[model samples]
Target: MLRITPRILAVACIASGLITAACASYAPTPSSDLAGTSWAVQSIDGQPTSARSPSVEFAAEDRISGAGGCNSFSGVYEAANGAISVRALGRTEMACEGGVMLQEDAFFAVLDGAERYARQQDRLVITADDGRALVLAPL
Candidate 1:
């Protein structure tokens, strides 16, 4: 026969609480600060990037510089309270492989629409106003 005593119930509750606290400690927390951070594009809109991936550096003075997979680009960005906006982006016009150019175009489009960003663990995800997302990994 089994008994359901108050002591057993209390021990079970404590065990559950301890387990939850352990898990919360290990969970990924949102990262702070974007300046001086650099990352290489891993994917855009859930599509994996190629070997020559676009890269970005959140430089000082709200300036951002990166390779657009085919061309280098620079722009100014504003980030505050989890919201982000990229603007005035300009890129070199050098020609590249067709696939690479297409990828660059898509990347630029997403940047143009960027509205928010989050750094989860090692991944930095920039999401657009239209729900498109760019996933990047530390460089």
Candidate 2:
């Protein structure tokens, strides 16, 4: 046998309403902006890439692939708590034209040093421990 009490029912309704509102107030998911995004590098360490625009793609499940201005590259990346680490990069040895090689080298160096990242409006900014930064936007 069960008894219905108005006070108990009212308390349950209030708790349910609060839970629903809390869920709705949460921030938007990062996957919409990060995962599967084709981010192209615009600047590194406050200097322009000066060659071909370097690009990065964050694949699902810790995989990353991109072109570093000259050569095609693939790497592993992990992000948690707004911190990121990039490693295990492998690239094709295709020769670069003019200053493209320099740009590639610099790009890799900055990427290797990435420790954290932020999304600013329409851009993705990756920062290093030494105050260097790499700025990227959707390609």
lDDT of 1 by residue, 28-139 (tens): 3323388888999999999999999999998767888999998999999988778999999998999999999999988999999999999899999999998999999999
TM-score of each candidate structure, all chains considered together: 0.76, 0.73
- Can you write out model 2's per-residue Cα lDDT over 30-121, one digit (the tens) per residue? 43336678899999888887748899999776778999988999888888778998889899999978688888888888888889999999
Q: Residue 129, candidate 2: how far off, in angstroms?
A: 2.6
The numbered model that scores best in lDDT is 1
- The list of candidate 1 runs beyond 4 A from truth reads 1-32
Quote the positional error of residue 22 for candidate 1 in Å: 50
Model 1: how far residue 133 lies from native, Å? 0.7
- The TM-score leader among the candidates is 1
Note the Cα lDDT for every prediction shown: 0.91, 0.84
